[model samples]
Target: MVDPRRAFALRDAFAQQVTRRLKVPAVEQRAYADRLQAALDGQTLGGLSGEYVVLVDRNANVQALFIYFRATPSDTWQMIGASPVSTGRPGEYDHFITPLGVFEHTPANMDFRSEGTQNDNHIRGYGQRDMRIFDFGWAQGQRGWGKGGISEMRLQMHATDPDWLEPVLGIRHSKGCVRIPASLNTFLDHYGILDAEYAALAESGKSLWVLKSNRQMTPWAGRYIVVVDSQRESRPAWAPAPGGKALAKVPAGASSAD
Candidate 1:
């Protein structure tokens, strides 16, 4: 079994690292760590045994996306990776806030990967090639996220055009979907998250764009994404804007997207 104290410590350490780039307060950090520890202890995130789990903390105002791996149902969760993301912007009628709760990944929703291609405007909205799109499907919220209705918000997690979004990561800017880095998106796609089983089948196909779907569940088929945000009133003072110099120094493969 893993040490609870150690796990909490690691969470705190990660929060501190995030605070350096984003604007998260120490109090909010402690609260988030405690909440995650409690959830893990309670085993509230249900899925097949040993399934991978993703935890997204929006409270830090930095949009921290943490990935954990487990070998068994009772095994200690291991923090394998993390990334900075941009989530939905807060607004009414059209722009909506990212909803908070536990969501299950279903193959019925996640069936395609969007290649980062340019539109008529010469903008690659989806980042690098072969970026996976994990569609949670029809999350209930206000109308109009990124082209959907109130009852059927096509909520998804996808890669963003690095040139357009890398500078704005760790902040809320997306219409509703989660915008991530090309490297991070590729990592998740290559290893599989919600679409692991289908991905394996696609590997032997003629083209990734026209691959068949296998929707089978596996030990490593992760299908849960937990999103929680801080209730704090003020944003952290250290968080920088999109093009600030403080953010420019981040290394290519560091927590921030390259």
Candidate 2:
């Protein structure tokens, strides 16, 4: 077990860093760290193993998407990166809620990505061009999850419309998917976790990561997404000045599992 004092110090430092970069309030950062700790204690990743895991705290009220990286399965998870996101809103799309649970991100469902191009709506709904979509299959048993018309609820994590969605970020506004910052989406796509095979496939003019066998092994292949509910009811006043001011950007190609 990690030392309690070290953990608290790490959490405080992490909170300070997030506040400085994402402009989120100290309270919100702390709350997120706490929730992350709880999730780790519960072994929310199930039997999956990897150097990093994506954690979304619905309780933080879509304030940000937290990315944790560790040296190994036995090492403690640390806050390595983050991006502001908008989750499902209340009373929208049949009161569609972002389901909470452990999910695996597969390459099969990620072929269709957004290029930040404007739709007939004439708005950038899915971030800058070539932004990859990391799909985790269906959520809520494939209930109401589409954007406009009625369709199966396909829970996905991708970038959002900077002009419209970004402003309303850090809140419950998305139909069911987790809307993230554009740069973050690109970063995750360009350098996937446990994604060496996928990367190789892309290099050979093939852009797919379909799982063929359960015995396949990769050191960096956990790519797990764990969503947790908020413990608080309201947003902290100190969290980043809401309304999407374009938080600090985390440079791509900078990952440390250790």
Candidate 3:
């Protein structure tokens, strides 16, 4: 029951916003025209479709996709990576509610190293350090939930389960990982076009391929804001790097370890 036209328009607006935030070249703007055409063709968006980046809003509930294709001119808006995830617990237990920004897949976090089955979200990549979070403590409201740590060992996309979809419907869920659902997890892990943030920028050459791609609780006037483009070698952007837990060593009456 949503307006797809408005959704596309909003996608363009926010894509510009995020592109400005990153401060890239103005010439890259043309890249969006092609992306626009592809979106109309039916690129649907769920993974690193072709060559692009994805943006999510932490300050707001918005998710957008920008297709950055360079190698071979393809008219398809591929879904890359995304943020604004509903991680951990919603309220009290959800310590790591991540923010909105550009994060990439690093070598250490690549989930393909494991010689086992990882049909879940942990197959994307891992974090630099254990990802600790600070999110709302309840299911619907926003209050500090103290802090918690998620090992840098599980970088996730979304969920691959239908039953596990509701919690992520603009609420909060997951255990400190970028999430999706069975509906779109495979596409995301399969494309892996956003192998690195730099590649993302190179894909677009400088513009954003915007689109309103999430089917969840969106409070934005339009649909959502997504930034699909590439970038140059920067600081790998800013990702949340959590520290060690600050819990007490032991109780006053408890005995010490050997």
Candidate 4:
């Protein structure tokens, strides 16, 4: 059901809008694609032929997210764009390490928008106002604090505070949710990159207030967010760590969703 022409156009738009890019080699792209297919199979979810899927490496050494598009279930996934992100950082109380698996973004969990309000520490927990929070409902995650056991944590992909935390996005800083750049947030929202269900509803004549009226939605809107940990011992040169003293000053428990 995906229009090939529109899918290509969306990829082009991704390149223009997403500023931070990760140059993943063709081989690595294939590997991630393999992983994505495996996760989907494990979860018993159908392969979304001609749809776009988001992949994230939650490894401590490499915190990056990728957008991939496939023309068919059997086709190779082409990398559309990549960006730096912050995954769960466990070491403090109430922090959970981001779970690894294929998570589906659906209306069952109900996505929400950030008010962009600052907490007492003067940090915008969910980035600026109107930022879309891609909710995946409660997921079992490894506890980063306490005795380090497993617990249920709400898994979400959203933008972090632009001024204070967005700069250090490459490193782990969130409680359990995935923190992304405001630009990437806008890119995903405006394109309905992961809004497959929302688009479907709209097509059925259901008006979703969350979807922007001026949006240029792709025909191949996807619903899966595949998270994997490469378990790399060191950071690769292509995925450089964030520099500056600001990395050290990232406040503990900065995420508001915890």
Highest lDDT scorer: 4
For model 1, residues 163-222, the per-residue Cα lDDT tens digits are: 656666777766667777666665556445555545555555634442324422233646
- Stretches off by above 4 angstroms in model 2 are 1-34, 37-50, 60-62, 141-152, 194-221, 244-258
How do the predictions measure up, each by TM-score?
0.65, 0.66, 0.35, 0.93
Q: Name every residue pair that clashes in candidate 1.
A: 59-230
lDDT values of the candidates? 0.58, 0.56, 0.30, 0.84
Between candidates 1 and 3, the lDDT winner: 1
Off by over 4 Å in 3: 1-50, 63-90, 112-144, 147-155, 166-168, 196-258
Residue-pair clash count for candidate 4: 0
A best-first ranking of the candidates according to their lDDT comes to: 4, 1, 2, 3
Better of 1 and 3 by TM-score: 1
Task: Tell me the tens digit of each residue's lDDT in model 3 across 1-258.
Answer: 543223233334334332212222333335444444434334443333223344432321222223333222343432222222333333444334443223444333323311222233422222112121111111222222545333232234433223223222232334434433332333333333334432244356643222112312121121112322232232222222121231132122111000
Alpha-carbon runs more than 4 Å astray in model 4: 1-6, 248-258
Which model, 1 or 2, shows the larger TM-score? 2
